[model samples]
Target chain A: MEFIAGKYNYWIYVALMMIGFYAMIAKGNLIKKIIGMNVFQTAVFLFYISIAKVREGTAPILWDRTVLYDNPVPHVLILTAIVVSVSTTAVALALIILIYREFGTMEEDEILRIQKNGSAVPPGKPE
Target chain B: MIDFALLFFLVVCAVAAIQMRDLLSSIMLLGIYSFIMAVVWTRLNAVDVAFTEASVGAGITTILLIAALSRTRRMETKQCVPPANLLIYGTVILLTSAVLLYGTLDMPTYGDPGAPAHSHVAPRYLEKSYEEVGVPNVVTAVLASYRGYDTLGETTVIFGAGICVILLLRRKI
Candidate 1:
């Protein structure tokens, strides 16, 4: 339908966000959660870019003659955000690697168990 | 028309994000949500905000997530019992939504020429920004000059976050 097609971008955005959030909360894998977080952030980026568009606006750069300019402020802000995101990602990955080194398995429950017990225990141990 | 549909999609995305079980799929959905938000910003004529949302929200953030995923495990090890604090979470979500909806009720109608925003200092900036700051974009003028101090503070906060993340993740040398 024309109505559906006209607003397809928004629909896609929502679908992606839902998928990411669900993955972050539902999946037990820490790596998968990170992926979900990435997808979530990307959805926001798509939203911001879509807003910057103008039907007939020109680029922010000025010409000798008069011209209607598309907004450039969001572009500048997004650049900064990108840098920050990269730094954050680096840090998050480092922490994840450390977690893996500390625990033989990447499973959350196993890590929790190790944390609670302080040492590996036999499977049948009640305590 | 389109606006109502967009709002509906937003609500649907929020619910699905909360309800989905696969963390990977949820992350992808979050990206989709951000994209929709960008479209909303465009509809509202806030082009600058929309640009920032797209590049940062969709591109960099997604990459970061993938990188993080590579460093961690990919599967849930055990089944987790649902938390007992459901009532508290439900209450919090409800209160926040109510407050947000209430705030929206007092907002100016979309694209109203008589709105306070159009009559304020913004008009002056729109007229004189080129002569005053030599910038073609009024949004940049406002961000870099009118609210330069706030921008500076935001930059500082970002730097601090970077430092904190590094400190937390870096192995002691």
Candidate 2:
């Protein structure tokens, strides 16, 4: 009980990461995979932010000399990371659009079957 | 108490996002999940990060996904993977979770002020940011001046992604 209480935050984030990971690996739809990827990334961010928490501390802004503040490093790191995550998602969405244009579907199994059979979409051109 | 609620909602959202058959609703749950994440961040004193998560994670990501959804099939078309293959994937995921759970054993307890993360450069930044950078918000000071290069690199990456999106989606010759 003590162990669980001590690190419940980490444990929860770990579960979130696994949820995202399972979606990315086990799900068939391309959009589902992308959603899973975002969930996984956010879980990592949550873990880092959790590390920066101080029991009685305030936010990282300078309020008073005598006051404790949460660690500022992870917040800064995650700020940049959040932007990078969106960028990756944007690129991913773009790729998904092109994939749909070429293959006419976003289901992973369908795409793989098309690739293997080389029948649904022509080899060189989409026609 | 609130933290527990938010975490519970988070798990619920993730699971529901997985189980949802409609691609649109799944994306909406993803937004809800990101919003809950932002709340969790604020509770943890990551206001800047929370703002980013709300804007980027919930707002931009959902928009991009929905727009992409507009470009493709809306409903998920899933054919079951054979049970043997499903079992393999499940085993690997569970093993990874076990290893990560093992790792948490060594981590500092939640909100321990004396944790190693606080003993390093974080303390220095908190102590000297007002003197060195003339900024009250240490996160802003560190993001803009202390680690300006990384932010610049992040912007460059975003620019690259923008270019990539334009390249891939624009069909006109």
lDDT of 2 by residue, B5-103 (tens): 899999999999987889999999999999999999998889999998998899999999998888777888756878998998899899999999999
Task: Extract clashing residue pairs from model 2.
Answer: none
**Stretches of candidate 1 above 4 Å error?**
A1-113, A120-127, B76-83
Q: What is the C-alpha lDDT of each candidate?
A: 0.56, 0.90
Instruction: TM-score for candidate 1, please give it.
Output: 0.63
State the interface C-alpha RMSD of candidate 2: 1.6
Q: What DockQ does each candidate score versus the true complex, computed on alpha carbons?
A: 0.18, 0.73
- The residue-by-residue lDDT of candidate 2 on A18-112, one tens digit each, is 99999989988888989999999999999999999999999999989999999999999999899999999999998887888777888888788
TM-score of 2: 0.95
